[model samples]
Target chain A: MINVKQEIINSIKEITVGHDIQEFIEEVLLSDLGIDSIKYVELLVSIEEKCDVEFDESDLGADALKSLGDLINLVNKTLEQKVS
Target chain B: MKQYEVKNVPRYFEPHVNDCFANAYATVLSYMGNNPNFILTDYLNFMYDEQTEHIGINFFFRATPTVEFSEEELNSSLELAYLPATSMFNKTSPIDEVTDKDKVQINMYIHEDQDIAFTRLKERIDENKPVIVAVDLFYMHFHRAYQREHGLHAIIVTGYDEEKRTLKIIDKYKLSSSDFDGEISMDEMSQSRLSECPLNNPMVGEYKREIRNLWMEIDIDPDFKMNVERIYSIILESCKRMKGQREVLGHECGLNRMEAFRKDLLLKKESFMDRKLDERETYLFKTYYNSAFKSISRSRMRFKVFLEESNLAEKEDLGEVLEQLENALKRWDICANLSLKLGIKKSIKLVDDIVRQLSSIIDIEGEIINKLTDISLTRDLVTVSKNIKDQEM
Candidate 1:
């Protein structure tokens, strides 16, 4: 009974400070949120550690991480695969 | 399949300074039993093109090609240098197929699945072939700082063992002292090869014969002189091209680009004061500064080597020119260190002083080049007269 979205939001908060979690929308670009290339990697590592899920090489490609929604969907998909 | 690794792969460190494409190409040549140094000198001779970009603040120098040397130039040089090597793969296409050439061939193989790519790579390694792979630096443990960023890098896979699930890789970075040779897990290797952030292009170079009697057919003295002329022309044109131009980030070339970089430091300082300096800008500043510093340092090193190897190091005027170049390089090092230690604000203050020093060095370099050109032309005339007299006799 893990709240995957909440877990992701919490992980994002820990990695990036000063961002209002409630205002985070699915359509907002990660770059607009000040998540640069290096910071984006850090966020991915943080989420992996918090969720205890390892992203596959295919999952980490450029096409997989376009926006907040994309990242959230990826985490959910990986979580589902883990449970199965 | 039997496990194997190629011996005497030329290890080129100084990743921050030397071009990785050149280093990887050198490694392949060394593995094929060729003198990497001689080949590198020959290749660098033809790589410079006199292209100028007018950025707003200053003219940027675009002297060298950002990509590898053209396939025709590279392949023909291999043949001319008597290396018994030929490249059959097309440069425009992605990893397609391996075509056999004389004694060695450059191969590219593309597979959508990571496992398939690893399988193909392992097949080559089993045959004692060292593969040159284009990988995203983010997945490499050695370059963790660049994680998730699509920084493409080249490395040689020398050996692999299925039982141990490890692959032997050679990476040269940070001066000759930091050459890397170790076993990374098969998983890491596969991920690096299959990274899609950057285009997934996996290339493996295979060499069979050891090159003996390493001789370059081109007349060393005249060719070297021509290279020197080319270098001087590029630098001189860059200096003159800076008139009434605004500084631009991506468009600046040569010394003009260096001046534009100084302007960037001042702008960065303003951004820092406003608390608007982000991680990306910081990363770009460091990259541009290092590249500018390394270009000058590498040029100085190349010329010094050329002079020493050609037995011209003892020339009184040329020796003085070398000393001037060394002093300029030292000042550049100091400027770089100062910028790193004291943030942008203090460093911006030193920019004008450093630019003036660099301009003076360029003027001195131009004078020395004029002297060298005179000497070269005189020697050529003397040789022509001797040849004519011999023919008449």
Candidate 2:
């Protein structure tokens, strides 16, 4: 299986399509990435599609997504759970 | 190729006021330089009716994102706020009955016939009136929603080329919010005007209205005079309105509605406190909360402008009011932003923060009302003094 970290990065790039903020540092706050409310919805949806795992829209990984690193970790944890 | 275009239309992006309808009106008003006061001050007046559940602003400060405003409601809202409700303007506010050539008329229409619509747009452009038309962003190439999302929006159509079948749009509504103005094919414009984007973007939420070639033709007389009495009365009405609830155009509105709304928000927060929230519930909650604060925040900012523009508020009075208003505006922005975050991530922290911010906003708004009341009483005293001095002389 592809590395879950790679999958999250790819999703980030995909969401940044047609957007100005293309490159981002992992330590950057997710807010600094210019992901507005609309983009936030799109990113969450994109991450769900990319990981091939449905994120609990309610609170599963949403609260966990304050930073880029958090998103990567959340996706990894989700993937690990899937494997188990 | 036949062409009709209105030249030098001002771009519509008023700071702290992104309401498409109001900005659209600003386009033509600024172009003529006719009624700066009307454009700035006298347009938006707060109206809250306790009889119903309508606690929002007048037509000019309204949009079609989370709410579908009816024609009657639109007219009545203006009438209650500060106007006698003119004809069919999709985006309108308080229309003052000014003297001389400084007359403003708004005519709204929903045409099923594209040809008829084109003819009307051309007719207005010929008179230098930049028409504000309702549109669905999905059909417009410039918008990110082109073929992606369907949400109702407004744009200014300034020109058209017959052979190319293109309309020049200055879509400055929420320019910071991913909306852009660009030329579009007549077919795209027509389709957008008559669109039914049932699956609208979840972010902006869905509206229960039809676009259907709906457009507003604004006829502003090139000479405008500030109606201080009218502006003063509207402010006075707001001072009375903030005290309690009253029915204005069938919507239960007032500053009191905000507390009730705040309580509702608290309930929603508690419901999602220790429980997994439903997706639709979250979306609806976010949409409803944002729409309210968006209008409320916008309305207060405009009120601040209105007060300053009227030249009625003394410098000291205006200073204190503006500072407090600006603070409250910032807090409303914070609350709205937090509400959206709460929608994304169910957090009691976000809820508590919004509740705290909103409570402060209410207090600041109360102080604003009292200050405005003092100004009004001062104005009345001056008016009576002038009359008595004239009699004594």
Best by DockQ: 2
The segments of candidate 1 whose C-alpha lies over 4 angstroms from its true place after superposition are A1-84, B10-17, B42-129, B142-150, B175-179, B198-286, B312-317, B338-343
The models' CA-based lDDT, in order, is 0.49, 0.64
- CA displacement after TM-score superposition, residue B170 of candidate 2 (Å): 1.3
Error of 2 at B120 (Å): 1.4
lDDT, model 1, position B161: 74
User: All candidates' TM-scores?
Assistant: 0.52, 0.74
> Please, what are the lDDT tens digits per residue for candidate 1 over residues B1-393?
445565665675422234564577567666665544433442111111123211211212232212233344344222113221222233355332323222233433334556545665666666555677766567777763346455556778888877788888888753322256888887886676655443221111221221111111111111222233333333333333332132223232334344454455455455566454454444333333434444544545554454544444236656775676566545544443332222222333334444454466555545545555555556557769999999999
DockQ, candidate no. 1: 0.02
Best by lDDT: 2
Top TM-score: which candidate number?
Answer: 2
Q: Per-residue alpha-carbon lDDT of model 2 for B5-52, expressed as tens digits?
A: 888787757755546666776776677665443444432334433332
Error of 2 at B253 (Å): 2.7
